[model samples]
Structures are given as C-alpha cells and as structure tokens.
Target: MPFTGKSGKFNAAIRTVEIGTGDKAVKLGGENVLPFYTFDAPIENAPKIGVLITDMGLENEVAGIKDYYAGATTFAEIAKKAEEMPGADFVVLRFEGADPNGENRSVEDCVAIAKEVGDAITAPLVIEGCKNVEKDAELFSKVAEALQGKNVLILSAREENYKAVAAAAGLAYGQKVGAESAVDINLAKQLNVLIGQLGVDQANVVMNVGSAAAGYGFEYVVSTMDRVKAAALAQGDVQLQMPIMTPVADEAWNVKEAMASEADMPEWGSQEERGIDMEVETAAAVLASGSNAVILKHPTSVATISKLIKALV
Candidate 1:
C-alpha cells in the first residue's frame, strides 16, 4: 500500500463571527481544524489582529507608540491612524475612563467619545470597558445603542452583568457580544450557555476566555485554550466552539518585567523593547494555542505577528 497522510480535520468548526459592515468587515473562527493547521483542512477565516487604543489619547504612550502616531493627538486622530496600521484588522476603543474608581468618567462622556470614534473610522470597532461590572453594564449598553449599526463587539458580558450587556448588544442593537470568563473551560462554557439562553444567536457570540502575559504562569492560559479548541473540534462541543479573542496588550504591558524602566532594571534591556517582546510572545502563544484573534497595542508587534500568520497559514 502507498504511504498516505491522514487528515486531522474534524466534523465541527468554530462558529464564524463577523463584525463591522460592507467590505471592511472581518470574520473570526470558521475553521474545522486546529489553529494554523491548514494542511489538515483549509482554514476558512484567517486569524485577526486588532489594535487597542484607549480614550486616554496616548498621553503617556511609550516612545514607540508616541512616534507611531506622531502629531495625531485627538481620540479621532488616534483611531484613524490605528485603523490604518500595518496589520490592524480592527480597532478596539477601550473606555478606561469609565471606571468609577479612577477617572469616574460619566456614561455620557464615554458615549460621546465612542460616537466620535464610531463616526470617524470605517474600521470594525470593539468596545473594551473599564472592568467595573456595574459601570460596564451601563456603559456597554449605552455604547451599544450609540454604535447600533456599526456591529461592534462589546468586550464583554460577564456572569454578574451578562443580562444587561447581552440583551442590549446582541438582542436589541443587533451587534455582537463577547462572553468573557476567567481562564477556565467550564467557566467559558457556562457563560456561553448563559448568553445563549438569553436568545442571542450563538453565531453572534465570541469568547474572551482570559489571558496572561507569557512567563507569568501562562501555562494555565495555554492549557485552557488548548482544551477549549480540542473540545470544540474533536468532541463536537457546541458551547466551546465560539472563536477565542484574547486581549494581549493590557496584560502583557502591565507586567513588572515590561513596565520596569531600564534605570531600575538595567539587566532587562530597553523597557519599550521588553514590553513589545512580552506582547508579541504572548499573542503568538495564544494564537498557536487556538485563539482566533489577538488584541495588541504595539505597531511592531502587530506587523511582526501579521507576517508570521501570513507565512504560517
């Protein structure tokens, strides 16, 4: 018998979630095999890269990020430039100011900024909240309503606030909802279950199953993603079949290794270089572990990862 290669494709595929509209819309998931395993079967949609910008407008941006934007100072200017980044498939507008503990920015103010960014850029939009459950519930709902037809993905609907966010974003506004859970397979599935029970279409849900910087006990993150992908394809797990999108910027750049200045930790090399390295490594790790999309803040990281994806897939 002639030697033959066995195909590893599975019967089930990750559900396709489309954000944005018209020609600029991007698709996530929709592949039957494992990540980057095109040899097994054709990956229906290539993984996506999203550049994250906060409403803070890059005030304290690192040297690299500052240089990238140059004279673009306003939120709208930053967003437009981000949309035009080398490999940015979409732009994430994080409303960090909405955190009641910090800036205590009001919902109205955040909404105004969201609308401004929404109107300014044609690229797909993703709304990242300030992580305050109560504030996010209100902020996300209002932003969802504000960006109604933009088909944005609210990041995200947690256990405590799922009802309000999911209902408003997925049901009322006709946008996508992100079901976020800690780095646990069971938690991820349960949130998806809860979201599904809300009458939201499964196709409209994406998973943000938590993330961590590489080398920061990241094994757990990798294992969690690995199991989710395995169960989705091999075990036909519908609840776990949603595409995974990990936010790598906040987690990677905040780690002490990335944040420590060269003066404080001269052995760590350049602080900016360290931050970018952590981000790129973590994003690449998650992608290989089955993430369909990864959010990054550095232009070099985005360009590098984009080239890697192109070469691999």
Candidate 2:
C-alpha cells in the first residue's frame, strides 16, 4: 500500500515548529505533504481540537442556541463533557460577558472563571474577549494577570488593543498571545508585527486567520491561511510562521445548519448531529488549510473530529 503524492520524504523530517506550549501544548504545520497521504511526508502530530466554554450563559445573540447544552452550565460542566472526547488537547474559554454590549461582565468575573477552570484542567487554556475594545482591554488585562504563571493563550491583540493585551500578556510570565484579523493576509501580518514591536517574543505569539460559515465564504478563510503558511515556509516570513488559530465554534455555532431545529430540517439530521457535523466538517477543512489550533463547540463534535484526525495521523 504505497502512499499518495511525493512518496516517503518524511523518512525522519521535523522541519517546522507546529505545536505550542501552555498548560497544554499543540503542534501545527508539520506535515511534509497533504493530509492522510501516508506515502507522502509523514505527519508529525495529529491536528488538535479544543472545546469552547463561555464564561457566562449565552446572552443576546447566542441565547437561542442554549438548548444545545441542555442542563450543562459553567466551565466545570463543559470541561467534564469535553474530557469525555479523549482527544481534546485543550480548552478555550471566551469571556462573552466582557464584551460590554453583551452582559457587560466585569474583569473580575473573567479572572474568576479562568482561575476556577485553569486550576481544574491539565490541558492548556485559551482566553478570548468579547468584541468590545474598551472592555476587552480591561477584561483581558485582569485575566492575563490571573493566569500569570499559567501558560495560556491570550487572544486577540488587535490593531486597536494590541498595546494593552500585549503588555498584560507579556507580564504574565509564560503566557502566550494570539493575533486575529478578519480574513486579510496583510492585516494578519501587520497585527503580528505590532505585537512584536510590543516586546513580546515571536515564539509566544499565535496568529488567528478567523473562520466563516460553511457556504458564506469559507473558501476565503481557507485560502488566506494557506497563503500565510506558504509565505512562512517558502518565503521565510517570520510573522507568518506563528501558529494559526481558528475559532470554528464561534462561527459554526450560529449557522442555521447548527441551530436549526430537527423539525425544521429533518433531512439534515438531528440537531445534535447537525451541530457536530458542522464542527467536524469546518475543522477538518481548516486542518487541510494549514491552521494549527481550532477552538470548537459541542462535546460530541469534538469527539467526532478527533476520530477524523486520528485516521489522518
């Protein structure tokens, strides 16, 4: 059984740094060739999936999807459910309340949730803010300080708030930072440059290429991440070399395919299965597109995706 495309180059190759470090570390972009092509370059590490747990209950926007989790509440319950997957490498906790527009959650609340969940899990933790810039600055600052010695990824130092998030993340000792842009390659590069200017080490920075709904423009997201990785490996661009992050849960959780009632779309399958399918499909797509880390929702989805990843490895 010979493998496909460029047979056997990965006899013993470990060229790039695919994984990251924190409470839990992940490897990305180490495959010498396309996914599951055994005769090609051997894959160094399996693509990793992390589950998303919100700090507070879904408020205005996500309230409609709350039924998905049913009785589950709090990060602890989410963590317990995520552990059932067996392949989930880490957890990403988004402080939805801190968005200023959502629940207007305070910085203290964000810190408390991180402390509680970070202490309970051995997997690495990723902290994200609501879309609000001012509140994001305040909330991330506190969470960064709280996770201090704990190696966690502090997302989202944008052009608007890079200074604040970088300053705080840098002070947190082993804490790492993530830079996100909509789907622009140039913007993603610039954000990484800005974070570097802030005295944060490049090794600790992760780049977020962002994700889109299935039919709405997923190709654009996929192309941009591919381009970023190519520029890094072929052109040796330092900014593009940083690990890539994709929030599949954030995008997929709201799609009609995920939240539609089984009654409304029986042909699509059960709502639970539909939601999990959306996550697995989107995640596997990104894995092929060169994203290193993916933040996902639905415990069942994580489990399903993990199986897909194992088959690739």
Give the clashing pairs for model 2. 3-39, 18-27, 18-28, 19-26, 19-27, 19-28, 20-26, 24-124
For each of the candidates, give the backbone clash count: 0, 8
Off by over 4 Å in 1: none
Highest TM-score scorer? 1
Whole-model Cα lDDT per candidate? 0.95, 0.72
Model 2 per-residue lDDT tens digits across residues 9-97: 43322234323345356655555444455556566666677777787654432332355555666767655555444667877888876
Estimate TM-scores for all models: 0.99, 0.84
In model 1, state the lDDT of residue 186: 97
